[model samples]
Target: MTKNCFLKESKSFFTLIAVFFSCCLFAQQDDLQSETENEFWRNVQFGGGIGLGFGSGYTDISLAPSAIYNFNKYVAFGVGAQYKYLKQKDYYASHLYGGSLIGLLNPINQIQLSAELEQLRVNVNLDGSNSNSQDYWNTGLFIGAGYRSGNATIGARYNVLNDKNNIYGSAFMPFFRMYF
Candidate 1:
């Protein structure tokens, strides 16, 4: 065959393949959008937690808001935002802001298994003769279980990377959650 004819046929073959794949991609995307629009509202839940503490020379406060999508009776995926303020007189004060990815499983009635990963920015200020401040990112992973009653869940989690200097504080933390 002539060189020009061979090149023309090759170009046509490549163009056909490209068009086929593009159509397939768009078809898959449309199916996904249709499913998402079907019962999206029924699977959505919104709620979170609030924490407060007081002491002679220290105070702690936190607010966390979360939303979840239940995939089935046994599985859920969620996201949340966290904000915390800590102050210690004559010592230091800090602000924590972060977000988290959460997962849950219900193996039986009233029982839930939970896990979460959080990434936070911690800003610290020291009060002293020579004051200093700094900012950094902290990440934490927690795993635990909870008891669910109606719209409330009470649980205790252990942070795998918890340390005194970690913005999340203790290794063992109790949590309260509500869903609407």
Candidate 2:
């Protein structure tokens, strides 16, 4: 009977150890899952920026607001809109309204490369003419690089567009963006 008692005691002790270890492992897994969820939601971000460019016969200033949703650490997609005002050397000022699609190479950490395509409506007033009511559509392609830390991003882009007069040129824009 002594042998039977000893065997029962050893089995109970092993069972208790197994349950304790299993509970610890489960708790660790739960903590890891919660952390991962937090990081995923943190990848969703929003930002805005302003920039200027100077070219022959015109100087341009623009504002853009953007938002992004990151499904993971390495990929993100976003949409944004921009408003641009252009002042020509001897012509009436023009206004442009546009939107873009933004893609990122790496979204959750520091460095990223981006590409964007945008379409705009350009409205211009003819000099000294009552026919200040001309409107046209333009399309732009922009390629850029960026870096992000905390809530701020700084980037530069090369933008090309076809205007109403079939004028095509490249503009450089420096921007600051914030994420919330």
Candidate 3:
């Protein structure tokens, strides 16, 4: 329910994952004919989202990189890490870092449906205090649908577990997913 969650330590862990995935992304070669066809690697995809917004001394920045394994044309499962920082000049500052499990289904090439469960460690300091003023775990389970194309999906999801200090700020959030 509540505990000391170190932002520094988790930052290191996420950094390591980011490096490993970056390598995988760069290792991809365009000429498949010249290389061995590894079915496992072929069905894997790497991509994520970055968000930044600032206005009138308020700032929000987020990074979420994920990898998914597609079992076939119809099913997929994956994990992702998320980190978001929110700051309002003289109000409060928050750090949210954690991981999620996601499952995807495509009944047809044009439609995608998904279910995602996220567990996050939240830390907030009020009035710019350097100490951790609040620490807690927040959970969200989102069910969504989107329009799917070659490598992208645009959709909105509703968090069934939406509660106090909701992670995405709303019960409904829009998402853009791309895998390459």
- Candidate with maximal TM-score: 3
Which parts of model 1 are misplaced by more than 4 Å?
1-38, 129-131
Residue-wise C-alpha lDDT for candidate 2, range 25-142, written one tens digit per residue: 9999999999998886787788877888998987889888888887676777899998988888877788888898988766447977778888888888766775665898877787
Candidate 2, after superposition: displacement of residue 105 in Å? 1.7
Rate residue 178 of model 3 by lDDT: 97
Please write out the lDDT profile of model 3 over residues 93-155, one tens digit for every residue: 989999999999999999999999999999989995677488989999999999999999999
Per residue, candidate 1 scores C-alpha lDDT tens digits across 10-82 of: 9999999999999999999998898878789789999998889999999999999999999998899999999
Ten-residue region with minimum lDDT total, candidate 1? 126-135
| Native-referenced Cα lDDT, model 3 | 0.90
lDDT at position 67, candidate 2 = 89
Better of 1 and 2 by lDDT: 1
Task: Rank the models by TM-score, top first.
Answer: 3, 1, 2
Clashing pairs in 3: none
| Local lDDT at 179 for model 1 | 86
